[model samples]
Target: MNGRITVRIMTVVILYHPTMLLNLSSRHIPCPAKTIFGRRGPLVIEIGHGNGSFLRHLAIRHPDWNLLGAESSLGSVSRTFRRLKHAGTTNVRLYHGSGLFILRNVVPVNSVHRVYINFPDPWPKKRHQDRRLLQSSFFKLAAGRLAPSGSIWLTTDHAEYFDFSVANGKAAPHFSVDTTADPPAAARKTKYARRWIDEGKIIYHARFCKESEPAHPIKPTITTQPGTMHHAILQGTIPDVDAFEKQVHAFDSGHVILLDAARPLGDDRLILFVRVDEPELTQELLVEVRPHEQGVFVGVMPFARPLSTPGTRAAIRITSRWLEGCGLRLQQQSF
Candidate 1:
């Protein structure tokens, strides 16, 4: 809500470069091995590569395999980058957002050779069980993405979660559950796994092999386009800084929230921090309001690299209407 919020986000962008991170905003993932890694190899994904220890191991063990790591934590992504850089690992790429998004959107169907889920958060609380990743629905979803006879290897220290994954896999109708299997040697080499082993913890492991296609095959739903741009021009005066307030716009698919407004110290332009929340993805974008010859321009900046989705278009319209409420007349616009 404060101006300082923009400062924090800028600091993060300055620290991390774009080489290791995938641009989830892209519409289709045609061929990641050639596009991302600059070579062809089998695609392997690690659902939650904690600290990149196991991911680094995989890159070293199989240089011919293209490895992808999906993690939800920004700090973990940063730490993993440091480790990969130190080890000079090249076959690995990281996604610094939701693992589910990468699995659902970025990964091509029937292209993945293997998936490694090491020590996923158990979400032990009953109410939080729905948040766990290894659900029956996940097994169904993974089936549509994995290659024929491809497998998912899981290793966790929690007994209940291990059983939960096994039971869910059995119910999915796509995977053959194998509870009596030793995990890959790389699984126990993670930081948490090594510490748990030293403390004499019993770690559970399983391999869910993809047996067949889903009974009801699922397709990837992509509402965002890579090149499409949305914006609007209004004929009116600039909005009063004090009049800016948080506003929410809801659509059938998702909702967009205009969180706050900030004006640079010497610039006449205003920046609106927005949060766009959809079913599978959530993005933070900055909508810029700048003065034009006839009126004002309300649109997302090119630097934001925002994917043009329904929610995103609604965001620009919401901002334009808000400015109209502050005495701006709609002239010509695109949404």
Candidate 2:
């Protein structure tokens, strides 16, 4: 899509009123308010945190700074979640969603003190370059979200991605790029950093700082015209029965289920349902049986139509068994 088109689409789908908190439930845990510097400490966010090793270390070593990690992969999020739980670390929060989403919806304006992009996937192909995380657009977004004195620290072992990142940072008028001769002393002993250094691959580090206030305020604008149904949902209004049926039909044909439901466990939080044919294969299952008085169950069954067949019946049976194991009971009707 053209840049204008893409921006517009993102504006519509991604942007929301700053006053309204988007995705607040995902960030359930409170962040530590104090920083190591004794003042309200800076908020540091790490993007693409794979296993939370670096974040865990950082949180412990720098107890004063509040930390947040954003990982798009659920598996990675779950792994990090457990690791933090086991270690009893309370300074960090995990956002299991896109970095862009978090930046737009969750992070307050001029709220982030630092950002770390560590070894993000390099979509190497020429046509796929747009998929690379460090792009001109992202640079602008980062600049807007960063505090006036804040900076972004990026590290990569891939030569091409490093070069691309440097070039992108330099091209942005707001950023002043700095290339380091050696890894920061504080970074050297980490397992990932050590391994990269041992391989004789020179790690590239760059600090991108915004030089001035943006000429324009970054506001959410709807870009892609939301489908009729989604438009209704966004407006806090339910679509008609036909549109809802079409949505459900679409879900039934697909293998995934995306449900917006009230927390099954008597918590004030909300729950998202990801329906699977054989839940056991996924390893863990936690079903909430009760709902908070104010919450309602919202389920998005991806393939509801075709899955009603006898062959698919086994999958449903397996799913039910798994939910039962997790202490989730089937409700007699939508509560």
Candidate 3:
């Protein structure tokens, strides 16, 4: 094939490769290797696999291992997917979500044999420390998912965050911290590692080994079932757009905020822009309130595939009930 034809074919493969992308919007435990990759093998995870250098290296280094990459940025995921596809790496699967979400919801307990977190964002300011990923809560969550004796290897150029992670690992239950060990060679081959190294920055490494099961059982934070249509039926007048005020509802694990209401120029539907904040995922989705012959239908808009999570369900339910207060009668709800 010509060079142009070869480039187009590769681009199509990278864009259309469906099997490697794990959909976090669906609530399926994606471990055991067989479920997603059609075979059983040792499982290894690389959090924040920026540009796919480390992820591709791990896949190439250990072809028998099932590799999972959790990345928060869609752009990075796409770039990494392109690199991985071009490398013909088949043992790896990537998710465009937080590592915590993958551990808590998608990965089964005692399934992971190793985890690599290379040069995570430090969130340096003291006020933003809570935003950092290597906290006590994460160690506890990791403990529940890691196999007995499974280890988490962390590599970072920020000394303060590295020390903070070591402290957090010590404070968390069921993990033994080792700060003197050498990081895996593939860890240093990441883009961030090379950049920091060339700039004369000192890198840090640590290993947190799971020594025992978690003292408290860790469960999936989002309990709502996926693939369900969340809506409500009302027998009274349709909600008035002018009276729509911002409403916030707090739940055990997350909160929902009803931002604003609008009506389409030529349609009888009211659009509600909602913000849902859960521990692992935050989604800004639209909910629609439509007037039907039987009743008023209030549900999540089907235009986008937002995860059917707790906060999402709450947004629909709260909007329905709030409309009741605004002169609409509640009839039924599916949440």
The candidate scoring highest on TM-score is 1
Residue 25 CA displacement from its true place in model 3, Å: 4.1
Model 2 local distance difference test score: 0.54
Candidate 3 lDDT score at position 233: 88
- Tell me the tens digit of each residue's lDDT in model 1 across 149-241: 988999999889988999998887888888888877778878878988898999899899998876565666654556776889998777658
The C-alpha stretches of model 1 lying farther than 4 A from their native spots are 1-4, 26-33
C-alpha local distance difference test of each model: 0.81, 0.54, 0.81
- Residues 1-335 of candidate 3 have per-residue lDDT tens digits of 12543453354345455678764455454435567677988889988888999899889989999999999876788899989989999899987778888888777888889999999999999999999999988888889889889999999999999999999999987989999988888778788999999999998999999999976658876644457857788887765566556778897778998877778799888888787889878776778889887799998875435777777778888888778887888888787
Better of 1 and 2 by TM-score: 1
Task: Rank candidates by lDDT, best first.
Answer: 3, 1, 2
Estimated TM-score per prediction? 0.91, 0.58, 0.81
TM-score of 2: 0.58
Single out the weakest 10-residue window by summed lDDT for candidate 3. 1-10
In model 2, the Cα lDDT at residue 273 comes to 33
Clashes of each: 0, 22, 0
Which clashing pairs does model 3 show? none
The residue ranges of model 3 lying beyond 4 angstroms of the native Cα positions read 1-17, 25-33, 170-173, 236-252, 259-269, 291-293, 302-304, 325-327
